[model samples]
Target chain A: MEIAQSLQQVKSSYIREILAAASDKNVISLAGGLPDEKTFPIDLMKPTLENLANMPEVFQYGSTAGYGPLLSFLNGYFQLPETHTAMITTGSQQGLDLIARAYVNPGDKVVMEAPSYLGAMQVFGLVQANIVTVSQTEFGPNLEELEQCFAEQKPKMFYAVPDFHNPTGVCWALETRQKVAELCIQYNVAFIEDAPYRELRFSGEALPLVSDFCPQNSIVLRSFSKIASPGLRIGVVTGKTSYLEPLIKIKQGADLHSSVPMQALLHGLLQHNNFATHITTICELYKSRYDVMYAELEKQLPASCVLKPVDGGMFVWVEIPECDTFELAKSLLANGVAVVPSPVFYPEGSAVKAALRLNFTNATPEELTVAVTRLADVLNAL
Target chain B: MEIAQSLQQVKSSYIREILAAASDKNVISLAGGLPDEKTFPIDLMKPTLENLANMPEVFQYGSTAGYGPLLSFLNGYFQLPETHTAMITTGSQQGLDLIARAYVNPGDKVVMEAPSYLGAMQVFGLVQANIVTVSQTEFGPNLEELEQCFAEQKPKMFYAVPDFHNPTGVCWALETRQKVAELCIQYNVAFIEDAPYRELRFSGEALPLVSDFCPQNSIVLRSFSKIASPGLRIGVVTGKTSYLEPLIKIKQGADLHSSVPMQALLHGLLQHNNFATHITTICELYKSRYDVMYAELEKQLPASCVLKPVDGGMFVWVEIPECDTFELAKSLLANGVAVVPSPVFYPEGSAVKAALRLNFTNATPEELTVAVTRLADVLNAL
Candidate 1:
């Protein structure tokens, strides 16, 4: 049977393919936006794990919105307004997929910063959205360009990772956040704020979610993958109750709901006294690794290549002289390192920027040092 | 924001809404197709649950296809051929959603027997598939009509619950299975065999899946929801390698993957020595419940309301004298029993038989007895 036309344009995620290759024992993989497995607070989860056996109710069918206890706990945790609500998803990635399917029509304009999260592009692409791109500055999307895109394209939504983005790790400035929220409210374009890396802030004070400024005009996706566990595949989407109800409808078809045991486990962990400290611990651990990689790149990289220091999140973007990035990535892989080429993060056929995204969270300081050396050697030859 | 045109036509699941109503303490809900919570083999899952804290790897992102060990184990567990493969879904509900999203384009014809699974109808409806239905008989789908529909409509797929079918509980005759498979292959139509209840059979000899008759022409969806646990929200879709790959692609965007820890826990539970015994235990237990419900309906239900005894599965369909099923169901709910109106099972605006689907699984025999009395009084009044 022919695959659906919607899926025809969606190439399987390149990062996933590269992540698979990066799994080789000899390779130091910075290709995936993976939280370090060692940082998973299994100790904090032990009580929940042991107690799960006694909670047979979780083993039965659950509500599509989420487990009631988890949903109630999140209301207090997020301090959501009375008018707002939350729905659980298999992951924040699924949260994006649900949003796209819920609101996006074929040929609907969906605005995103160029070099945005690849997974977001894939989800929007699956819905056949006309993905409009805005240029990214050091502080989120270029404000002038975003305003222009909103005015001209009349996009249905603006999707972004406002806090420590996936590929670039560019946290939106507070002014940028407020202005973007204002523009979205003025233009009626929903702001889809994806905050998977929000809590991973180690070196900077956290800013409010852009959605906070335009609560009724935006949806926020929060992920536990970075802080708690990706293996749990649990995510939360919060917005006006009206905005989230449609997503819940689509989610009913998407997966009924995410795993109840996982939700219960996450609820238990989130309530644990040590959970906040656990986040700080992983954040510090990741910051140290990032320091090593950043230092090595500063010390050893060729002058032609530009490097930017990230305050948080897993990756650092390295701008290279215009070259075939896929080939560069392939060569880096051959040298026992894995990094995602920048093109994968952009919409297909968009002007390709020659760059690579290197992750620091999954690898150790020594591995980060060696991986950066391999990366530098490859760049030096170029 | 306007919802996607695709979702505009879709309605929130009627069954889910009624299931919510059924949650009232005074309501004995046969509205939901939920297995008995007691039937969940938490004991079988205990060893795996305790071991989960030690396996930090499960806390990390896993392959989009599935957890490695689970897929490999299912390969052996199902004894799938060398040409076949499996992909895990959040639930069998999601397996259907993926199939619909991956393959069924809008306006594409997909065939199902009338009085089919509501979830299947919801999924196909979400994709905006042109759902063409043929009449169902006591033996299965009317063979002559199925062949006629296939030949004329040239549907993309034939979706069915071949073993202990939903709502109508019409398990196909062996000949019907062979003929459906033959017609699908001959018509170049794919067969989507959703066998969630295949393992729930309490009587009659187990038969080979319709897919077994034409392996290359079919995809089989197997659910652990009924047997293992729905709260885990894990299900498997298996078919030839080529047939299954597109689903994995759609699944990557669906939720990245099912919960890895849940997948690992499911994997470990599947490997437990008592797992097979657990299935037998549930089958026996549900059989007793089914016997009670069937007996009560046979003894007390008016002759005007025709009842079909199911060999297995959670429901028994009662074809009442032509009347408004929705009103009847509502009145029954008011009298402290909750059942699904049959119209929800058919495609929107399709001619709905004046019948109701009554679940026999979740409630105890005593509850079932009282629920049937309530149902009988309502129907007798109607």
Candidate 2:
């Protein structure tokens, strides 16, 4: 059977290839956006795991919207307004895919930063959306360019990782969030707020979500993969009832619903008294690793290379002097350090930037230091 | 924002509405295809649930194909050829959905029996497939009509529930299965054999899967929902590696992978020594319920209402004198029993046979008796 034309255009993830290669025992891999396995709140989840046997209801088919108790808990936990609702997804990845399937027609315009989440690009690409990109500033998307694209393209939605942008790690400033929300409302565009790393803030004060300023005109996707467990594959999508209903309909066809036992386990973990402390612990641990990597890069990297300090999240973006970054990545991999090339994050055919996204979350402080030393040595030779 | 044009044509499940009404305390509902909650084998899963906390690797990200151990176990368990591979889906529903999204282009021809799975129709509808329906016989599909449709439309695939079919509960005759497989191979049409109810048989001897006749030309979907648990939402799809790779690509964007911890739990449960006994216990329980429902329908329904005894499956289709089944279902619900209308099963605007689908698995024998009496009373009045 011939594959769907829509699927033909989607390239298999390049990062997956790099991650596969980086898994060798000799490599100090930073190629994947994975959280450390050790930080999983398994102890906090023990009660739920033990109690699942007592809850016979979860073993039966559940509501397509979500496990009802989990949705109710999230409503109160997220402090959703009466007009808003929460629906659980297989993961936030499914949430994004549903949004695209529900709302994005082939050739429909979808805006995103050039350097954005690779997963988001893959989802939108599968739907055949005409992705429009705006350059990014330290604060957020370039407002002038964003406004021009919105006016010109009349895109259906603006997809973003506003908490700490993927590949770049730039959280949108308060003013930027408010302005982006205003633009979305003014242009009748939905703001798709993907907040997978929102709780990973280790240094700076948290800013309000872009959707907070335009609640009726936005959809928010929250992932548990970072703070809780990726293996559980549970995520939440919240928006006004009207915005979320179509996604629920699409989701019904997509997977019926996510796993009910996983939802119950997540609910139990969230309600635990120490869940907040658990998040803080992972954040601090990640911050220490990030500090070690950043300091090492500052000390050893060639003067031609430029790096930025990330307040939080998994990655630090380093701008290398212009060269063949893919070849550079291959050379670094052979030297026992793994990092992602920048091109994978951009829409296909977009201008390629010479950079690498270095993840600090999964590695130990010592590994992070050694990996940076290896990375700098390769760059100095180049 | 307006929904995608593809989604605009798809209807939200009418069975869902009937199911909502069915949940009333006073109603004896046969509206949902749910297994008996008592048969979930929580005891079999308990050991795994407790052990999940100790399996930290399961809490991290897993391969998109499936958890490694589960895939390995299924390989030997199913006796898959080296050329074939198995991938875990969120559910068998997801396997069907992935096949549609990965292969069916807009206006591409997809063939099914006139009265087929409602969820299958919805998934194909969402992809804008030009669905062609062949008439179904008690044994299986009308062979002449199926071949004619295949030759005329040249559909991308033929989707079916070969074992005990949904609603009708008509298990295909052994001869029909072999002929269908031959027809599929001759026409170069992919056979999508969805065998969710395959293992539910309590009396009949198990037959080889239709795929066994044309392994290279088929994709098989197997579900644990009927025998194990639905809330876990784990299903397996197996086919030639070439046929399944597209599905895996679609699944990565659908949800990175299904819940890995759920995958691990399912793996452990499948490996337990008592798991075979657990399946036998549920089969016996469901068989008892089916017998009660079948007897009650035979004793209570008017002669004008036709009933066929089923060897296994959750439902029994009752054909009534030509009338509006939707209205009949509403009346039955008003009389404190709920069932699915026949029109919802057929493709929209097709000539629908006046019938009702009554589930026997979830309800008790007493409720089955009461529900049938109510159903008879209403039909006799009509």
Candidate 3:
């Protein structure tokens, strides 16, 4: 059967494909943007599930928007004033899919940071949107390039990670965020800020969301996957009332709503448990792990290897000049260490072939030491 | 902001709008395709949640295809004698959406029943498919018209409900299923047989699905929502190996997968409890409610009212000649009763508008009796 022409353009995430082929006994996987399972609030979750089981209405069909109490809880969490609205989604991924369906038409232009999260690019591609990419600097997305893309494409929307951005672990400075907000206002383009890892910061005080700078044209996406459990599939979208209303409609047309029982479980966890305290402990744990991984890299890697210290988020981006990250990844897999090539995080067939992303969160200190030693051996052999 | 052009072609479900506006306290809602909350296997579910709570792994990220045990269980359910592959989805709604994204391209020909489930129509619209509707008869879709459509349009696929079909309550006879399967095979068109209500048959032995007749060209969808709980949002799809591979990729790209915790809960329910026995009791309860509604309609409806007996399923189709069903629905809503006008289910906006769909599953016998009496009175006044 002839499939959708748009599907011809849909490419699988290269990292995911490589991770799938690696053996559990040998592979030290850093290919997936996965949270450390050890930090999952299982103790809190058990009681939460018990509470949900006791609530008779929790097991039935919920409103197409979400469970009311959960939505109310999210509204409080996001600190949205009475004027703004919030809706819970299956995950941040579903939030991205809903935004695409709601706002993007065929041939409509959508702007994104050049090496942004691959999942969002796949979704925009499925919607048949003409994608325009802007380069990213250590501070954030290149402001000049962003303005140029906005001026040239007049994109229907701009999707970005404003805080502790994925793959790069670079947060947008407050000034850069302000400039982006002003540009959105100037161009009348919607700004979609996805901040799934905001709460995972190890050291600095959190920055204000880009949405706070331009509330009228911004939508902020938050996920419990990084802090709680991805299995529960809990996420929320906060934005202006006008945008949220249509997103709710698109969500209704998607999967009716996110899992109601899961929402109830999450609500119980938030209300009854010391969720903030739990997340603080998790951040400390990840911070220690990141320190261990950083030390291992310094001790074991070649002097030519260069990496920017990740302030927050799960991954550390490493650049090995003139070496193919994909080939290096395969060699590491053979040596029992798994790391994702950087190109998977970029648009299909991008030129960022010399970089690789390593995740420190999912591995233990001993494992990280051994993995880094093996990775150094692979690089030396190359 | 300009929304997607495809959305302009997508019509919001009229039934959803009516249900939203009508007061819950006074309204006898027949507009929702909802299962009886009273009949939900609550006892079975409590233990299921307990079992899931005992296993923390259930609360972590699962394979994109789905949880392994649930997929294996569904494969057994569908492919008893021979092995087949199955993928879990958010709901049967997501199943339709994935199929649309994977198969339909702009202006691609797709066939559906004239007065079909509105959700399916919404999905096809998103993909910009040229939808052709085949008239539905008492036994099933008019095979003659379907063949004519196939000959003329060379449609890529035909979507239908063969068992306890929505609104119409018509199950395709065994012979009709075979003939439709043969025709689809001959024309090399895919068949999507959605069987959400198959387990809810009040009487009669189960007829084999169209996929049973033409295994190579059919994809069968089954859901735990109608039988268990829609809040959990778990559904399964089974088809040939060739088709299953691409769908696995599509499901991965869509939302990673459905909720893992829900899949675990469902697996516990299926294994540890008499779920089939519970469904039997629920079906009998709905059958009683169906009888009560039919008796009330026979006694109180105007002489001009045309009614069709529903053997099983949630709805009853009623036609009132020379009166617009939409206007009648409004009058019924004013009188504190709700029904979905049939025109909303049709593809063409200008199609027949004299019928209304009444659901008998969600209300008690006394409530249904009172609601139908009020409905009859409103029709007489109209």
Candidate 4:
């Protein structure tokens, strides 16, 4: 039972550790990025799933490319460029894994935000990429630092979450989006834009997609995990055919294809309801939950412990002055609250000190209020 | 974009190319190993899928390990050793991919049959494993050659298909299965037993599983794709916790988890029906089709062209005495039939000459008769 050298490079995810620790049933978990299950379209899904099981195609093997109807739907929905192609993945996580395999050689340079999606970082690490970090400002990755890494590191891939980034929940400004895309083109790098939370916006106007800015080299990863159903595990990666051919080749050996019944179910849902209406309905439900948690945290937490309000997405980033968030998280877990510390999302030596990410979607208004008060008390004591 | 060095090693799958070429709507493809859709449990699934969709848990994110109920079902079904554990995969293909990542380091030696599953070979290629091939005799891999390779190559893993092997419909003898397990222990190697078609047996006494012989290092992969439904993409990998731990760690970055709705649907099916009765029904259906094709080929083909009789499995391996099967396959496709040539299944230097693999599972008895008649005509002419 010898392990591969690459396995040594991967660490068990901190989120998994936190979630397991949160399973005491007494802990209020703000650790995972799960969308509230109550908001799932159970009423709408009954007929859709019934229709899917009757179709013989749902019981047969699908093309490695994807389930055809969903492929057509995604191609139209994403408004992919004529030269670009779209392939359905098991989820956005598989999309990242495919991209990493397509472009990364062991020790190849890759770039990411200081606090990015932890899952993406794990994929890059498993591939043994030489990861470089760029610091983030409120708007996006710091343009100056990004340019320096692109110039010096010459990374093979630059992974970004331009819209409603995980952990940070910060949407990139329109100018920053364009600049990041341009930097990839100039540096001859693949821009891996993960946009799972793009449709979860509660208030702010949508910015241009990084793919929209540079369609040639930029690859976009989208998921139905948040907006539709995570448990069904449907997602897609879109890019120019030249880059996608390698990803598809690697994907053939990965999982063959995603589950066809899941794809057919999503296709049926799209046919039955307007996609925009579905997004808006879920947004309204999560918006109020976000508001309650933000308002209570603002009232209870000291000014030194800042809770940054997000316009959209699941997480609210908090900065605790002169406190280690990891130690604080352990203490808070003992006090019946759970939050994700910031270190797991960073490249070593570049982690933000005293930062934590709190998820607002899963908790009810009352549960969120109580959880934040407990969190605030722990922060104030520190 | 610069493709990863690993991608250079991956030749595009011959099955994929054959299937793509067969999509012209004229060719009757005996190339892919797709189960007959007519046997799919649509009546049983209709209510089950509907019920699953209404459960909020089916639409939310699942545990990375698996859906709990299904995990419990498999853990019991396999009757795993006390030291062993099991985890769900998107498909058995994913199970193979995870095993490759968990054990293969660059240029590590791995053993496989000369004519093995093409997809597994592709996974080994993606990881750049030093694949050592052992020639197969009528029953299984040549014992003497296998022992020589294990001793000399000192391979990290020995990948075997002890039951209903792909491309070549050969099952290992009881003694051969035990010998493989004993050698792996003797050489400190992992034995990867892929059992996708194990349950599809229409006749012949069951041999003990390789895992039953050596639980310490054997990782067994099982799938519902052949027996239940391919579109659901449910599969499992079982092994001692020592081997499973790395696989679980690697699986986290792969796809997070298998689709919960699909797992629940399968779980519901198992709960609703006698599993043995379901297996018997599908096996009877495919066995009739297999008989039709084998009878037709035996009657029409020349003496030099031999069709091997399989006890039970989807594929029938044919050896063409003096003709190139690749060229024969191309000519047959022109005559409205498609078959997979043996070269794709072999190691670089050891391809079995003038052979082809024909799948009997997907087609009807009528279709299989026509397909073999056309194939026999081409073989006789050659």
Candidate 5:
């Protein structure tokens, strides 16, 4: 049978390709965006599981919005303005999918960062949205380019990871965040800010959220996958209720609701003070790992291959001069080290780039050292 | 903030309207299709939750396809044909949505039962599929009507619930089922068989599945929502590997994967011999409730209202001559009972109907008796 034209347009992610090659037992995979398992709050989760087992109500259907208690907890935690309503999602990915469905019309223009998250791009593609990309510059995403895109095409939505961006560990400057929010409101375009790594800061002060700058036009996607657990698939979409109401309705068609027991488990974790304490512990661990990976890269790699300054995110972006990262990635996989090529992050699949994204959170210091050494050897041979 | 044309085409399910009214303390709902919370396997679930507390791996990201052990268990249990591949879904609802994304294109023709599951209709609408309905006749969905539909329009797909269908509680005649399968294969149109209610039968011989007839083109959707716990949201999509491969990739973009802990919990529940015993207990309880409901309708409802014969399944579909079920549903809510009107299930929102779909599984026999009596009184007053 024939596949839908929309689905036919979606390109497979390079991360999956790299991971498939990393399946050999000896390969250390830094390609996929997975949270460290050891950081899971097992002790905090125990009481929640025990309580849920006895309360048979937890095994029944929940409202399409989410479990009431968890929703209430988030309402309090976020100190959400009256303008914004929040609903639990299966994950940030589902949040992106629902936003695509509720807002994106076929052939509608969507503005995204040049090297945006591939997962988000795939979802927008499946809805057949015409995506336009703006490059990330030293100050932030190119504002002149964004202004031109919005002014010329009046895109329906703008998707960004303003803080701790995936593939590239750069946070948008605060002024840039404020300007983007203002532009969205002026152009009558929705702004989507995905912050899976916002809470995982190892250095630097926290920046104001895009939603904070413009409550009515901005929507935020929050996930517990990094700070707490990924397997639970706990996340939320927060925005002005006017914007959020449509998504909640579409979410009903997506999966009815997220797992109720999982929501209750999230509630239990948040009820105690340990939730914040646990996040701090994870940040500390990731910081040390980041330091080790950075040290190794500086010692082994030539200065021509620039390694961007890392502050808070899980990944370190490296620009390798005169090389195709995709071809280089295959050789690195053969050498038992997995890394993601930069082209997957760009909207245009064949856009030229020689950058590699290496994750520092899922691997230990010893493993990072060995992986970097092997990567350097591969580059020298090339 | 203009909504997408695709989303604008979607209509909300009537169950939501009834549920909102049923929130009053005095109201008893026969509206939502929820399993009896009392019948959930709390005892069987306790040890699984306890075991999951220590297995920190449950809190980490899993493969996009599903948990391995659960996949293997289902593969063995289903004894799927060599041509078929299966993957776990967030719920049967997600399964429906993914199938729509994989197969339906904007303006593409889809054929469905006249009074099908509204949740499904909503998903197809979200994708802007041009849906046409064939009425369900006494023996099954009128096969003659379906064949004519296939012949005239060459619909891109046909969605059917052959056994113990929702709302109508009608099973297709053996010949009808075989003919539908043959037609789909002959026309090279995909056949989507939804079997959420298949395992909930209290009486009737098990019939052959559509997948058994046309393994290459038929995609079967299975759910554990009724047989086990809906809160876990475990379901599966089974089809030929060629067809399923694209869906698995799309599933990655949908939510990465279903909750890993929930899959682990489901795996634990299936390991014990009690899984079958527990299902039997649930069937018996629902059977008792169905009997009470069937009896109440016989005693109280006027001859003008016909309650379709229900051998098994949770609902009793009623057709009331000369009364609009939608308008009556409002008056019934005021009189302290809740039910879904039939128009929401039709492809066209304003299609005329005098039908109501009442769920008998969520309430006890005593509650059903009282609820049915109230329903009858409301109908008499109308």
Candidate 6:
């Protein structure tokens, strides 16, 4: 069959595919970056449904930009009163897809941190953008490498997960964030700050969004998936009005709008409950799980294995020296455990293969301990 | 400030934009192709939500292909037991968008009816496809013109709403569907069967889908929005396994997946309730509303105005001689009525300008009567 040339270049989302394959009842899966379902505020949803049922228009199609009330609430929640415009999306993933569709013409240049979120990279790939990657530093993306990539590639946009960055689980320091914002302004490149994990921070005080510093040129994507329910599929995009208007137009042609009932439910939850406090509870839960997983990995894993403690977010990044993570993942799965190989997160055929991402949020403490022991056994056998 | 060249060619959805503008309290809107809110099975949804509450997984991130039970239900409902694959989408609109992204490369040829669904046209435009429009007949798209288009353009695909075709409200006869399917197969052109309005038929038995006639190369998109609840935003696409597999991959990259709670609610509604019987009741309700609007148009419209009595679907297409629908729609709005200008439904700068699409489904009988009378007044003044 003659597939589109662009599709020939496009690969299936690795994390999603691996998670699907390993979702058996016995597997202690760490492949999916899923939020803890146990922490979902089920009691709050009852009142939310009641509120939606009361509103007659809740069942009707909403504005393409989003439900106006939800957008207003998001704007206030983000505390961007003056220069920001917010639009709701199906999820933060859709926000990235919309931005890709709007700004990326075929063969356009887009830069991102190496080993960034696989989903965002998949979106950029679909648009046939030429992806340039900068190395990941302990703080955030390597500033010098980014500057060099910017000068050489002159990319149209830079995509980042500055808040508790995915896979690496390293949040950008306030200084690094300020520097990146200034560089985006200097280079005339658009910045897409994906902050889906910002609210999940457990250790440090939350830093101001990159958008707060570079108000005119950056867009920040936030989702309720981490806090409330991923099943609701609600997210918000906040940015300068000029960029947001175009995104709204793209969204109109995408799905017309996100699910209205879900939007109404989210609005109801926000209005009626202390959603912020609930998110805090979720953070504490994940923090304890992260600690458990980190401690178990240290006690059980081989001396060659290095584990990075996740300050926030769902994943703990692990590096295995001189070992194929993919093979280790398969052996771990055979032993009733699942972990995602990080090589799939890089560009296709890239040289990064020794890293793996293990999710700490989905499994229980006992399960995490068992999974780590199983992983250690697999590593030792290899 | 610089818009993409692709966006320059893409216009806002005429129905959605006009409907938003006509949301004034005084405006008796007959422009939106939205299903009646009163017809929404709200009573059923309460129990459905209760069922969802019992299933903890309903609030978690579901499979990218869909919620498994919903896909299984759809497969059984559509009778695609063999040689078929199904995936859930945000809506049928998103399905079309995915097909466009996956199949239609720049300058790829695509075919549509002369006055087709505006949303599909907008998607094709965004993909930079060269669109060729075939004329329309009462039965459906003109088979002779479609044959000619296939011969001349060799389009990559043809998009059609064979069942109660939008704006025109014309159902394709069985013979027409078979002939069109045969031609597509002969030319190896993909057929996109959009059947959102299929279940809304007021009378006459349902015709077999084009996919039934030619399963090897056709994709069928069905939506629960019209019959059940648009607020849930659940829709499905079924087609040959070969083609659908790639589309499912594209969908995974697009939005991760549709809402899990929405799909769970739909699955519950389908399993626990007599949805077919509910749809029959809805058809009866729409039939009466359709008759009321038809009679009112006959009595109140200008002598020069021509209206084709539609068997099903929400809209009534009307042509007023020597009157531009854009101007007339503005005049009608001033007179506290709303209708969509027909030109917006056509390809860019098409010659079809003197027609309007008045929706009878969304308005009450009294509201329809008053709106039609006001429309007549506007036509008379013009």
Question: What's the count of clashing pairs in each model shown?
Answer: 1, 0, 1, 0, 0, 0
Model 1, runs deviating above 4 Å = none
What residue runs in model 3 are displaced by over 4 Å at the alpha carbon? B80-83
Clashing pairs in 4: none
Model 1, A263-369: lDDT tens digits are 99999999999999999899889999989999999999999998887889888999999998999999999999999999998897688789999888988899999
Q: Select the stronger candidate by DockQ from 3 and 6.
A: 3
- Residues B1-382, model 6: lDDT tens digits: 3566778777666676677779899999988888998888777677876556567788898888899988888888888958888999998889998888888888998899878898898888898988888888888888887888899888899999998888888889899989998998999999999999989989788889987888888998988889988878788999978888888888777788999989888888887557778898899999999999999899988888888888788888887786556777778888999888878878875557478888888888999888888888878766
Give the per-residue lDDT of model 2 (tens digit) for A1-382: 7899999998998998999999999999998999999999999999999999999999899999999888999999999999999999999999999999999999999999989898899889989999999999999999999999999999999999998889899988999999999999999999999999999999989899999999999999999999999998999999999999999898888889899999999999999999999999999999999889899999999999889898899999999999988999999999999999998888987888899999999988889888999998999898
- For A56-159, candidate 6 gives per-residue lDDT tens digits of 68777778888878888877877875767889898888999988888888788888888878888888888888888888887888999888878878889899
Candidate 4 whole-model C-alpha lDDT, 0 to 1: 0.86
**Relative to the true structure, how large is the alpha-carbon lDDT of every model?**
0.90, 0.93, 0.82, 0.86, 0.86, 0.84
| Collision count of model 5 | 0
lDDT measured at residue B37 in model 3 versus the true structure, 0 to 100: 76
Ranking of predictions according to lDDT: 2, 1, 4, 5, 6, 3
Instruction: List TM-score per model, in order.
Output: 0.99, 0.99, 0.97, 0.98, 0.98, 0.97
The full ranking of all candidates by DockQ, starting with the best, is 2, 1, 4, 5, 3, 6
Error of 5 at B3 (Å): 1.3
The TM-score that candidate 6 achieves is: 0.97
lDDT of 5 by residue, B1-382 (tens): 6878887767665677678888787888898888989888878877888889788887898888889989888888889877777898999889998899888888898888888888888888888898888888866788888889899989988888888887789988778888888989888778999999887878878888876788787899999999888988888888888888788878989999999999999999888779899988888888899988999998999888988777677899988876666778888888888888877777785355678889999887788888999999988776
True contacts kept of each: 0.92, 0.93, 0.64, 0.91, 0.87, 0.57
Tens digits of per-residue lDDT for model 3 on B302-352? 988888787688888887786667777788898989888888888764266
Residue B135 local lDDT, model 3: 82
**Reference-based lDDT, residue A174, model 4:** 88
Where is model 4 more than 4 Å wrong at Cα?
none
| Candidate 5 off by > 4 Å | A349-351, B349-351
Q: Which candidate's TM-score is highest?
A: 2
Q: What is the TM-score of chain A alone in each candidate?
A: 0.99, 0.99, 0.96, 0.97, 0.97, 0.97
Better of 1 and 2 by DockQ: 2
Task: For candidate 2, write residues B76-111 as lDDT tens digits.
Answer: 989999999999999999999999999999999889
